[model samples]
Target: MTESGRKLILSYYVSIDGKSVGPTNGMRGVMESIDDEAQEDEYVRQLWEAGAFLMGRASYDAMKGFWPVAEHPSAAPMNAIPKVVFSRTLDSVEEWGASSIASGDLAEEIARLKAEPGKDLFAIAGDSFQRALIAAGVVDEYRLWVLPAAAGTGTALFPEQDGPLRLR
Candidate 1:
């Protein structure tokens, strides 16, 4: 956590061209190509330090299908940490143990989570969900894994905005 208190950290992997999406082929291809064990270890450490995992509906759906069955180094932490998925459409999230759904106002929900006593809240959502958070100006820190390749044409990590962001 930062000096201010527990932070909202958004982590993502992006190509050199600023695309969070994988190569022209797809995410599997790019994911399989990554060979950085050090970075992987660091990511696992971050997960272990997180008080909870925050994500959008789509991300929750995607992860629910994989993490529960994945037998990877990070699976333990991924399954262990509490998760909050923001979605008005989701009626229930019982399948994912230690998880809940937040359908209230985005910023307010994040504020409520921040007020809780614990380590930092980490977000693991795609660009659309991140765009909403960015526009709300609720994110405290960004952890971008700048991959070594170019995606050519894919979704941008950050959406277009009217003003520039001042980062420390």
Candidate 2:
């Protein structure tokens, strides 16, 4: 948990090629492509359980188009959480849901959130943001969901590595 009354957690879904498939495996993909409604419901439920959510500008824009009218069971929860977006040009978060702009420095903001009284802040997408947090040694945990498939090559999840990481 964070000191400012929030917890920072990063969540990601990766393919065999290490690509973050937002367009394909993202919101639209889950709603239109996936055949399982139960899976979507469960994902939303889990997403909502978090006290807050953070995402990059790109991811936030993509979500703005889909999550509003989404009828999945998790929609209610997703619509309720406090959303924080990282962006410079976005004047205000006027999306259907309640959202706020990142106020402080990334690491500082995250630390304050971690100290807050909450379950954990969910880091929703933002590959670059995740990498920065990991490199900064601020990310406490890394939960990478390895999907059951493989792509020969494309946008990779692990773009650049400064050092070798020992993972269990």
**Which candidate achieves the best TM-score against the true structure?**
1
What TM value does model 2 have? 0.77
* Lowest lDDT block of 10, candidate 1: 20-29
Task: Tell me the TM-score of each prediction against the true structure.
Answer: 0.90, 0.77
Model 2's lDDT to the true fold? 0.69
Give lDDT per model, in order.
0.84, 0.69
Q: What's model 1's overall lDDT?
A: 0.84
The true-versus-predicted C-alpha distance at residue 110 of model 2, in Å, is 0.9
**Candidate 1: residue pairs that collide:** none
On a 0 to 100 scale, what is the lDDT of residue 14 in model 2?
70
- Model 1 residue 164 lDDT? 70
